[model samples]
Target chain A: MTHILLRHRDIPDINTLNVYKKNGGFAAFKKAVTKMKPAEVTEVVKNSGLRGRGGAGFPTGMKWAFIDKNNWPHYVVANADESEPGTFKDREIMEGNPFQFLEGVAIASYAIGANAAYVYLRGEFWELAAFLDEKIAEMEEAGYLGEDLFGTDYSLKIYTHLGAGAYICGEETALLESLEGKRGQPRVRPPFPPSYGLYGKPTIVNNVETLTNVPLILANGADWYKSMGTVDSAGVKIFSLSGRVRKPGNYELPFGTTFRQLIYEYGMGIQEGRPVKAIMPAGASSSLIAVDDKVLDTPMDYAAVRTLGADLGSASVIVLDDTVSMDWVVNKTIHFFKHESCGKCTTCREGNYWMRNLTERIHSGKGTGADVDLLLNVAKQMQGKCLCALGEFSTMAVVTGIERFPQDFKQAVRSNS
Target chain B: MSLEKKYPKEVKQLLAKYPPEHKRSAVMPLLYLAQREEGYITREAMQDIARILEITETEVASIVGFYTLYHDKKEGKYRMQVCTDLPCALRGADEFLDNLCANLGIKVGETTEDGLVTLESVMCLAACDRAPMFQTQGPRRHQVSRVHDRGPHHGIGRGVEEE
Candidate 1:
């Protein structure tokens, strides 16, 4: 009910320096720099049970702890390349509550002993990046970020880097490759960013929303941070509600909050009071969740979404009513994935292209039941074999559309054929 | 256009990270430099950059084509790209685009004959709420020094005074 990770919702104009400071914005950074040791700060974050909000849900503290401290001049990269379809929560935080996100970046940098933190934003976010640059300069002027922050040895500089509008860059390692001024493509993991990243140095990469939550976790203490969400997935999560909802916007609720509460209560119910037919709980990347009473009442979190055979990735809930044909939805998502595919891997690049053609044919009312079966087969073939999540996640809608809403696909096929 | 003078010593130093044999590794920075110099990448200038990188012109062309930031042709002084994606489209984007076009006296893909502004339709620019937005690139510069400091202007930078 109450916002934890996204306190800016309650506090107006948090983007402004004065308002942010008044709400004790930079307190976490100050504490981390002045009083607490970097390791201690990392320990607090580790104990808070904060996970990466960038789809994977990897523990934030564990990610920070993964940084090879022996590698000097460590780096912290904030993944602001939120290109996932139906995701807009990060944009809100970066544009409206930038300073809070910056403060979180600062704290994370300190915890990881990083001198420089780069916010790798999507190229479309150039204006936001410029705004963030101005904010960073403001923080630097205020001594909140710069040489000897808070008059301590802990120094941090925040830089904003823009991606050239590649969906693959949203993948952490691919983001690093792009930040290092390369073609945005995913690198092999296991050397996973911590050991080798950004010109081959230890790097800790976290999503924009994930970093935005750090300030709250540090300022409120680990136990306080843990008190908000379900026992496992603690703290509040921002759900970017879109499609068919009256109040389609970002809703911040505790991790375990149910989909019913998010869509009905916060979203002001479906637009025109239409009957909810389906839901994409986490943008185009998530498997479709049938919006029945069981799913509506299901707790909205990383773990709970799994029970419904989906992920709470970036909490980009795309609601669909009976009016929207499932075939059309899958086709749209397939088109996006196909166009945005980086072509670094075979499965995603080729699979998405093939699926897109089939989906287009299906949505055009030309595809038959055999075509639907072929699309499903292609999507299944793409699973577990993508170079990055973009390829892997692209199959979600296609697979789920045929599996859960067979009637919609069947009707679409018959109508078209 | 040569980057010798425009990038200055600091940028040159930064560019030095790539080996002489593989100067193509600096394509991203070079693209940024070109953007800074000419506001946006042109077809000829991009080909020239490919020449400098020692890579095939097609490779460079594909890179520029893939990314929305690099414009293939000349853009107007003010390019307002209104995103017509689902989110913005849902929030009266059509009306917003209509208003913008009406005010600018231009269509979605046309630039003002005076080269003052260009209206374009682009995929999600990542700003959903503040949707129906567009960005403008300033005019292209006329002069830039060559890499060897030999004052021969190439590409779009030819025949203008060096800054």
Candidate 2:
């Protein structure tokens, strides 16, 4: 299939505004602003079953519909803060096919009646941020952005905001806090972003990938997108294939593509053709799925992966071969979570601290079988208690690793003598 | 000299990006500018940023403390950050980091006698596809910043981020 989101793969130089406009770049956004009503633009997106690509598969259109209309001065913030370990698809999209993503951002702002939008990029992308700034300037010059866009009374301006290294800032609320020039930490729920966000205004915080889909959904009708993937999961997704794969990068496959296809056909099989041992489908946040024929053949969709006791959060498929030890893998991931735990809540901050110690001990042959159980217990304790998904997610691999790959722990714990 | 004086145009543009009332939003980028001269963030830079943004120096210092990129203390000429996160480690990033440190005759957190490189482990830089990869916090930012931690970005101005 031709690339929808990643047009750079299909069309070279789409990052340039001239090349993009020549290839129908901002046509949908222009159409929405010029011809369609703000609510009508939202209606078209609502009809399309585009879900949030930022881990949570919440329907994108429904999120836009939830925007509090009673509130004045709406805003839209693009989640370009792509910091999930093993997840790097968004970076390629922003770096290569930037205009499409920006076009999507512009469309969302028009739909939400937001005059201003911000792309919250991770600080490491300081260079990429500079590149995007130039692209934004080009769009503004081309009249796709800036005030009175497309001859409409409405005005839209986009800005790039760089976030200091905080994994927690990927969370919508935390992104909001970071944008407001404060420490990045997740706030409590109920007052979601659609209601209270970004200095307590009605804001629609969509992932860069999610917003990128808006232009396509508007250009090619909703059914065109919904017809591609499974009924429950519509549209194509960029599955970030990494680790032990012969070809490690992104595969823009429709949602129903099986794990077998992603690993073998797209990824070109495991590195050096070793037998696959386990898979972490959701980066560091996924439960270690002990791969078997059933799991391998399972379609890589939200519902299919969930049935196997793992959510396809962001589709960052980390393949593992028999040569790799699950215990060591857990230790690496635990270290990442430990360093990234926002410390806002005690459970995640302390629980990850405890798990990291246990994992280090177990990985180093200094722990006992009881210690493995205790690690699982610690992970369980941290679950359902974190202020955000990062805390609860830090436990997924630890708990699943111990449960599914028990032998790795037992061998590591056994006395060599 | 104050950071604003050294990079007047850059500081002015960054401050202009945000609202005049919301000048504090420029603090992070200004810190990036302030760190340009010294390898680490100096106390004076924080005060300069505070004065420019009208926020307290304590506020600017707290932000530096919160983010990993803005260093408080001085370090080697090059702060070579290797990502040994899950995916990177799966592709031999840990061994790569250890070997680089061993060759440099220093530990992960230690600097070489020449102060050319200081090895450190970062969570992730979102470049998992390129395993055994590390970002060099070059003194000149990106100019000298490469995988080996040399170039204009090798040992110069300040920068900032998480993976």
- Summarize candidate 1's per-residue lDDT along A272-328 as a digit string, tens digits: 898898888877777888888998998887878898988888888888888877887
Range of the 10 consecutive residues with the lowest summed lDDT in candidate 1 chain A: A1-10
Which residue pairs collide, candidate 1?
A365-A416, B81-B134
TM-scores for chain B, in order? 0.68, 0.85
Error of 1 at A197 (Å): 1.3
**What TM-score goes with each of the models?**
0.85, 0.95
DockQ of 2: 0.59
Worst 10 residues of 2 chain B by lDDT: B148-157
RMSD of 2: 3.4
Give each candidate's fraction of reference contacts reproduced. Answer: 0.22, 0.67
